[model samples]
Target chain A: MNIKPLGDRVVIKKIEVEEKTKGGIVLPNSAKEQPQMAEVLAVGPAIANDEKRKDEIKVGDKVIFSKYAGTEVKLDGEEYTILKLNDILAVVE
Target chain B: MNIKPLGDRVVIKKIEVEEKTKGGIVLPNSAKEQPQMAEVLAVGPAIANDEKRKDEIKVGDKVIFSKYAGTEVKLDGEEYTILKLNDILAVVE
Candidate 1:
């Protein structure tokens, strides 16, 4: 990919949710809000401070981030978001 | 003021825009957008990783943050926002 995030920023590809949950329950459109999970595509280089960029998150890691955390951008006709590392709430283990 | 953010989150009190500018020009209502400046009221405790919480930001620091970076909340009829430290772009100094 041509995109490279800089300074604590991360590029994320949103994960598509299936129509049915893992238990085989079909979700109605209203109940299926945008998924808060995404796969990390790229992470920025280290930032100015020692605190913000320990680089714990890596590419290919599936993470859950805050619902309203990123800026939407289009890449190669695919939608992605650019978020700061701190916006990532949890790493899905 | 009573709200305390958790896990790299920060509480911010937005700075209001005055009708008059510093150069003595009165800005019309349309000219004034929401100010992205705020005072840091509180910061959350550190997160799981050493990466996310070097804690460069501190309470009472004046900062500039992303325009859409936080969740608006009402506290005792006062407005505030809870943001991650990464949402804070720069210190006003």
Candidate 2:
């Protein structure tokens, strides 16, 4: 990824939900809502420079974000979401 | 107003659109879009503490904000909007 986010924005890759059930039945894409969970791919310079937020969110962190938040973009045939730091609700440990 | 905004939020009172036209035709509320201009009532601590923004926005300053931004609130029979500082697009001189 050659793209870098500006301000306090973050780049995240959505973590796809499991399609197969315990019974081995595969669910269709339409059966599920878009997952809000994502892996942080990059953090913007503002967040990086902020002493408080720099330690809170980092690249490779698994996070849960607001469902309706972020702008979706396709880069190199891969989809990612760019959103402000405030949109990320929690970091999943 | 007794309301105090948190974080980088601000409280603003919307400037009502003129109902009467030059030809003496009175336009109904439904005929016009809500005005995006407002008067800054108060600014949050974070914005006030920031050296750059403190000089940029001040109480009683007229400002233009994003159309869909801010949370509407009714207080003491008057209406107001509470929004983040980022939602304020420009200060009207």
Q: What TM-score do all the candidates reach, one by one? A: 0.46, 0.49
TM-scores for chain B, in order?
0.78, 0.89
Clash-forming residue pairs, model 1:
A51-B54
lDDT of 2 at B92: 88
lDDT of each: 0.74, 0.80
Error of 1 at A51 (Å): 14
For model 2, which pairs clash?
none
Shift in Å, residue B40, candidate 2: 0.5
Candidate 2: stretches off by over 4 Å: A1-93, B21-23
Please report the candidate that would top DockQ against the real structure.
1
Worst 10 residues of 1 chain A by lDDT: A46-55
- For model 2, residues A57-89, the per-residue Cα lDDT tens digits are 789988766676999999889989999988775
| lDDT tens digits, residue span B1-93, model 2 | 365554577888999877787889989877878899999988766677788877889899999999979766544467777788999999988
Docking class of 2: incorrect
Give the DockQ of candidate 1: 0.03
Candidate 1 Cα misplacement greater than 4 A, ranges: A1-45, A48-93, B21-31, B47-52
